[model samples]
Structure formats: structure tokens, C-alpha cells
Target: MGENSSPPDPVRSFSRLAVIVQLMMLAVVSAGWAISDGTAVAAAGTATAATAAVASVTTPPMGWASWNTFAAQINYNVIKAQTDAMVSSGMKDAGYQYVNIDEGWWQGTRDSAGNITVDTAEWPGGMKAIADYIHSKGLKAGIYTDAGRDGCGYYYPTGRPAAPGSGSEGHYDQDFLQFSRWGFDFVKVDWCGGNAEGLNSRNAYQAISDAITRASAQTGRPMVLSVCNWGNQSPWDWAPSMSTMWRTSGDIIYWGQSASMDRVLANFDSAQHPAAQSPGHYNDPDMLIVGMTGFSAAQNRTHMSLWALSGAPLLAGNKLTDMSADTKAILTNREVLAIDQDPLGGQGVKVAEDQTGRQVYSKVLSGTGRRAVLLLNRTTSAASITARWSDLGLTGSATVRNPWTGTDAGTFSGGYTTTVPAREAVLLTVTSGGGTSSPSPTPTPTPTASGTGAIRGVGSGRCLDVSGSSQANGAQAQIWDCNGQANQQWTSTASGELRVYGGKCLDVNNAGTADGTSVIIWDCNGQANQQWRLNSDGTITAVGANKCLDVPNNATANGTKLAIWSCNGGSNQRWTRS
Candidate 1:
């Protein structure tokens, strides 16, 4: 990724003259456009991009995943013990029901029929028996797989006996049907092989969803699909349509160790897409690391508060068979759980950051004028953070109750201030203020200025090229070896269009407004789809469609088609203007 340059090609010296000539022309056109219309288009699409959520799970899911504690080192006895522990530990009644058996439960070996087969020795009664046992205990069963032919274990070897071809690549329908036949209530698909093979996350997940639908119809059982691609495709934008939840970041814990507050906060920051979340579809910040090796009770509270405020899934990633009272208390807090499971299903947003590491987060609850607030202290010392009434959409005095302590914190007008210990967060339930319904709003991404340079894909190291150098209205946008051609030269106009070929603007075909919508060259029209925001995160977000310009299949091959997708912070979506 350094310098983002290729070694000198044989024709590089000869092409410079032509590239400079074309570059000058593009600059002239851009200057004229800026002079004529930049001011007029400045306010276009100024409204919030979107506010609707997809229909999926009614609320963020509450469950347990094995990867956090046991990982691939699982067997029938291990899972059965965890399932038994779930009930005995009171987590089941406390709303932690799904007992997920993450990776390592299966070997790569499939039968002649290509059906997924588990380790029979480890699973005496087979996978269905374990699922039945979980169901018998009034808990749902969850399983894991990869999108590619080989699972994650093959690459990371995080757990016992890593195997290859454990993914459901060529057998999407067959494998999902098999899982449905086996009675799994939930499936969390990993992206190890998908990333390794450069698969288009949106297309891959969509195919898996379709397969699951077919399986569900055949089995008469609905299954929850959890997309765990580590935010590579900006899953939030499109995942809700196909999944109950989608992981918005990488693993929270470093595995086999105590979860760190820094990692927890990092994950929280990555999952903040309030506009993309809706009832039944939630952002997943990986599994909860509440009782992990290194977390203090206060640290656990901070972690829990962030996830609850975000309305993210509350999947415990610790060993359930054994628990300390403090761990149990932090995991089973009813009030915090209620906020996460609120029927309103609104994800929280940062209302204020008074200082560098002092942050205030607020989420609207189901009841009128009710809001859940988290005042987080990330500094080295305890800091006094204030939650303002106006920020929480409240007027005058408001009653603040301590949910963790289950006591009233009294009413105050305008704002409430409290001391939060270093690396800790204070969670409160505020109500009964002259409350309005508006949620705290954050500014949309600041647009990256159109510059005269090559827009090179970070992952592919290729330049955005217009296919065939066609001047037609429907010329396809693609990537090719950076040749400094007129097609590869783009002027990010002040008006927000990535313009090339003098007048044709980079556009979403037909203004399709969906993930994987292909990019094309079209006559410039001040349309929303043609407008884009160059983000600091290295993505070009389409202003109208609210999707990122993406390379199909994460491909580096010449002629790879360019499209728009949910912005997952993937390198394929990252572009360097040089």
C-alpha cells in the first residue's frame, strides 16, 4: 500500500504526454463546471440519507456463542454441559437463550452426497441430537460456517484440528437444507474463505440467505442468519434485508485472554451506524466479552452499557458452565437488557463528547420520553461527564434512575453531571422530562474534494478505468492497469461527481439504489445517484443511494466491474486519489 504505485511499465514514458494532455482537458472542464454550477449543487441531498431499518429480528438478539470461550474445542459433552449450565446459571430465564456452537464442531470431510458431517466420536448422537437437547432445555441451537470452501480454522487454526473445505461454497443450498434438516435455529456464517478467495460479500451473503429461505420453506422452520464478515462490505446498508444480525467489526476479545477495554471501545466505535439499524435487524459487535479473563466488574459494566446503548446483540462469549456472582450480575442486568430489547429498536448515537475521551451516548426507549444514556470515561483518570437534557431530546427537569443500582438518581433540570471512573461508563434511565421524540443526529460524512489524480483501488492497486474508453452514455466503469489514460483520469468535481471523459459522470446505473448496483458513465445530470462523498475512511459513499462504490468479488483482475455496496470498510472499497 506504500506510494500506491506499480513498477514502470514499458509504455509509461510514452503515455505521460497523452495523460498530461487529457489531464489538462479534464481540469479545464472541471474548472468550468465549478464556475457554472458548484454553488448550485452544494446543497443537494442535504437531508439525512436514510432512517428506515430492515425487517428481521424484532430486537437485537440475545444469545451465546462458543467461539468466545470454547472455540473449536467443542464436543457433545461440552455443548451439553454449556446448555445445562445455561438453565442452571439462570441465563436462559434472563433472556440469554441461544447456545451457539461456533467453529471446530465439524471436520472438512463431507459424505459422498456432499452434506456437512460432524465429528461423530465427539458428537455421540450426531448434530441433531445436540440441537434437540438444546431445544429440550428451552434454548435455541446455533451453528457456524464459512462462506468459502475452507473455513476460518484452516487459516487461523484458532482451535483444535483445523480442516479445509468446511465452508458452504459450492453447496450453499444443499448445506443450508442439511442444517435446517438438522434443526439449527440460528446460523452464524464466518468470512474466512470468502476474504481469502476475494468473494463479493453482498452477493455471497445474499446467496446464503436465499438458500436459507429455501431450506426454511422445505423444513417449515425459520432460522436466524447472522452475517459475520467483519464489516468488509458495510453490511449494515444491505445485511438487514437478508440477515437477523451482521457483525460490524472484528472479534471484540483477543481470544483465550481477558477482553480489553480498548478493544471493546474500538468495536463500539466501529458499530455506530444508527441509521442502518431497525427492528429485527441489528448491528453485531461480535459476542460479549463480559466475563472474560481480564475484565473488572466496572469494565464489564462499561462494555455492557455500550452494546445496550447501541441496541446491539447481547451474545455472551464466556463459559456458561461456571460463573462468579459478579459475572452473572453483569450479564443478567434486567434494566440494561430491557434497553437493548426495547421495542422501539432505535440504535444509540453519541450526543456529546465533552473532552477527547469523555463521551455521552443516548438511545430512545419504547416508552414516551424515555432514553437510555451512557456517559463513558475513557481517560486515564476519573472524569465528570454531563448528559444534557437538550441532547437527549428532553426539556426542563428529567428524572434520572440508576439502572445498575436500581435506585432513583433524582430529577435535575437541563443536564445531569456525574463522576465516571477511568475506563468505566455510567448507565442511566431518564424519563418524565417534557420529552420530544427526536433522536440525537450526527453529521453525514464530509465529502472528499474532487482532485485531479488517479483513483486507485487500495486492494487491487489498479486505476478506475472506463471500459473500452467509450464516450457513450452507458460505458461501464471498471479497473485496469494504471495507464494514465483519459479513462483513468478523474476529476472529483466540487459538486461531488467523479467526472471523467470531459462530461460523463460516474453514476449508478439506472439509479438502481441497491447493493451491487453497477457503476457507469453517463451524461452529467445533477442527480443524487451521481453525487458522491469522499470519506476519510477511504470510501466513496454515493449521496443519493447511501452505498459505497465497491469492486465486485474484491477482484484485482483487469476489467473487474465497479458497483455500489454497503460500506464495510473493506480494502476493496478503499481508494487512494493520487
Candidate 2:
């Protein structure tokens, strides 16, 4: 009879079952989306558009960062002293403007409202005061944070942990606002506990980027975002829109007393990504280890030269106040700086390599046809490295100037061969026509062409080539061996432009009507100087000035520069399309 009574309570049983279903649904929603611990623990959405109010940094920032030298032991007094040293040491005048405080600047906990507070024990006067002092000296201030739930490093002096929930994970907006209010000009966001949280790197960084944009609007301060994820997740693929610079390698350790050679080589490999380099967005190979004790004088030179040629941000990690003359010389070379600061912003490439541990890296300077070459000998003993003019896109003699010595190493023709010590590099600027020019005496057969072929000089039989096969503006058009390279290929465009390399037009330098003006390859601006007409008599005439394209001195030798001369119907002026 009792079992039968249970059947009578069927309606009640259904009601209980409905209540259980509702509870399960509520639990699911709570677990999926809930703000916990004053941080956004939920997954991030797509990145928002960068704010227009904030201008993108057009060059790699030159500054001094704390983590490399001082690490977590940094304090207000140390930063202030460094700022003062920067000025007295002439570093500030040399363009090292930002004074940065790395990790351990924050208290172990955020306030009730999730706002981060400076550790009063280390920063007795607070961070704003420090920023103010730095600004008074005409320098900017930078601060660091982590993207994880807990920071990466601990404060060894205080014996305190990187406070839990102190990172930008769930509190990006709050922390960004706090950083802005503190007058920070730069923010370095690291990925410490981020991966442990199971967060996607792209989403996590985009969240911080959005917060930076929002905070910048509220505070009206332009903050340079430095992505310091140690090059994980290939930040170069996506960080340009969000940051001014990014780390492409791990922390450069002081291997011995100077920069570690292995780390330097790693950075060189990272710099091979050409598309990562641009105006304002730079490929950071970490700080310059020039003044550290572990490296020799030769290693220091190699370190600085590679950083400059690679377009890396030159953040001096050494103690500026106690630097030696040699260290200062390595760090403050204006000629080296010129290559790093060139307007072209093109990272140098490894143009030549050999099994003997010798390599050549080359970069084209903006506005000048000069090429900066670094001959590196990575072997344990001295090695001879040869840089053929052909490999460097030059055909004639070039004056080799050593920027480090501020003196010319004399003009070299054909090729410049030098012996470099082990673990050292030779930095030279190869400029066309600065050295003695020797015309080739060998007679080349007259080249024939029909369509889209090399424009062979009838007098020299050498093909018209873009110096160094360079697609850059102002690259000289010169006579070289007809090798069927795209830089030597020419085709008449429908717009009356003699185009090469797909779209660059054959241009008369500066549109000058005067004789002896060099010919160059420039963007198709539809300008008169870029317009040319191939006449029936196998002569290419400048459409604007009506001058004939002639080889200098009617030289039938390779490496002869091409120019616009008076149309005299000479063989040097005769050019076959093939």
C-alpha cells in the first residue's frame, strides 16, 4: 500500500524535476561568464580599432630600461640616480630619453576598487612624483606590468612575492588608468602567468591594447606600448597595430661581462623577418650589452654594429654613470647611430654566407645610394671575408668608409676583401664613385632585345641595372653584366613610363635638365622625370628633357654609371631593349 501511495505523488515529483533543471542551467551560465576577483577572467573578444588621438611612434624608441641591469632590485632612488646620470653622462642629449622602472614597483595587493598602488616602501614619494622629476629633466618615464594572474619575478630585497591578482589580466582598464594617472610615458606588458591561465596570447595582448587606448583617451597621455612576450606567439604578426616595439628574443644575459655572443646570434636570426621592421614599429633584440664586463672590445663593436644595422631599439643596459671611455665610444658613435636611425627603416639582410662562419649583412640607407655592410667572422680564429661588388648590387669602384673610425679605408674596385678577427665585425659604407673609377677594357658583344629584355648598352654591352638590385628610391641605374635579373628587366608601360621591378619607373635624378645627372629608379609618380620614350633608332630618350641615356665616358666596362647626356647619336647613347 505504501508503494501505491508513491505513485499518487507523481505531480509533485515532476515539479521537483523542473526545479533541478533550472539550477543546472544557472550553474552553466555562471561558470562560463562571471567577473571574479576584480579581473576579467572571461575570454577576450576581437581587438578594437586603435585610437586616432594617439600617434604611432615612427621610430624605434631610444631609452634606458631597468630589468637588464638592476632586475627586481630597482627602487625610486636608483631610478632617480639613473635619470640624473643619463643627463650628466650625455645620454639624454644623445637621444636616450625614457627612464624606465621595471618589475617590483607595485604593492602586493590592489585596493578594494582594483586600482594598483605603488609600493610605498620602495617608492616612498610615489610613482607620480618620480615621473614628475623625470619630466623636469625633459625625459619620459616607463613602467612594467604582467599579463598573468601573478607576476613573473619576486622582490628579492623585500622577500615578498609578485602579488596575486596584481597583473593586467582581469584589471587591464583599471591598471592602465592607474599607469596613465602616474604620468608613465611607456608601458611594458609581460606574459608571466598568462599561459598558465590558459589564455590565448593574441587575445590577452589585444585586451591590454584596448585598455591602453581607452586609458589614453581618458588621461590624454600618449603611452608607447612595448610588447615583451619574449617573441612567443610570433608577436610580429599582430603587434604592429597595438605596440611601438616588441621583444623578438629572450632576455639578453651578460655572457661573461659583455653581451653573450649566442644571444647576439639569436637576435640576428630574429631580425631576418624583414616585414617586422617599419617606421615606429621596431624589432627589439633586447638591450644593448655594450658596456657589460663579459665581452671584449671586438665583441662590443660587433654587438653595436649588428643592433644598428638590424634597426633594433638601442636601450643601453649598462650603468651610465660609471661607464668607461671605450663603452661610451661604442654606445655613442654617431655614424653607427645614423645607420640605425636611417629614415628608410629597412632592416639589413644577410646577403652572403659561407661554411667558414663568415657572413655579410647589408642594408640600404635612405636618400643615399650607400649600403652599410657588416662583415662578421664568427669563427674562433681570424678569417678572410670577401664582399663582391656584384653581390652588393654595385658594378663599379666604391669608396669604403669605416663609420667607427670616421675615415675612408680607400676606394675598392671589383671587390673588397678583408680579414676579420674571430667573433668580430667590420662595418663599412660602400658608396659608388667615391673611389677611383677604372673602366673595363674587355669588349662586350652588343646585346640584342625585342620585348621586356635587358636594356644593353651598345657601347659597353652591359645591362642597365638598379644598383644593388635595390627597389628603393634614388637607387642609381648603372651598367652591369646582363644576368637577367628583374632589376635589369625593362618594359614600356602604357603610361609612357619605362618600368622595372613591376612598377618602379626609370627616373632622371631630380628631373634636372643639366648634363651628367644620374638616372635612377623611382616610384611611378607620373612625373615628367620618370617618363621616357623609346625611339625607332634604338635610343631611349628622356621624355621631359629629351636627353639621351648615355654611359659615362662611353665606357665599355662593367660598373659604369648611367646618366642623361646630350643626344649625340653615339654608340654609348644607343640602347637595345634586349
Q: Tens digits of per-residue lDDT for model 1 on 1-578?
A: 00000001112222222223222332333333355533211111111112111122467778888888886788999999988988998888889878888988887888888877777899987899999999999988998899999888888787666688889899999988888889898898998899788788889998998888888878887788888887654676678667788886667765566677756765676576564565566778788988889888888888999899888999998888787899999889899899898865667766565564577777767666788988987667999999887666667689999989899989998889999998789999999568653333334322233345579999999998999977578889999999876678675532356666434578889888889899998765546777777777788888778788899778999999999999899999989876
Clashes of each: 7, 15
Candidate 2 lDDT over 273-323, as tens digits, reads 444455556777787778886788778889989888887888888887788
**Per-residue lDDT value at 417 in model 2:** 86
Quantify all predictions' global Cα lDDT against the true fold.
0.74, 0.69
Model 1's lDDT to the true fold?
0.74
TM-score of 2: 0.65
Which pairs of residues collide in candidate 1?
A: 56-280, 57-280, 233-568, 234-567, 234-568, 258-294, 450-492
Best lDDT among the predictions, by candidate number: 1
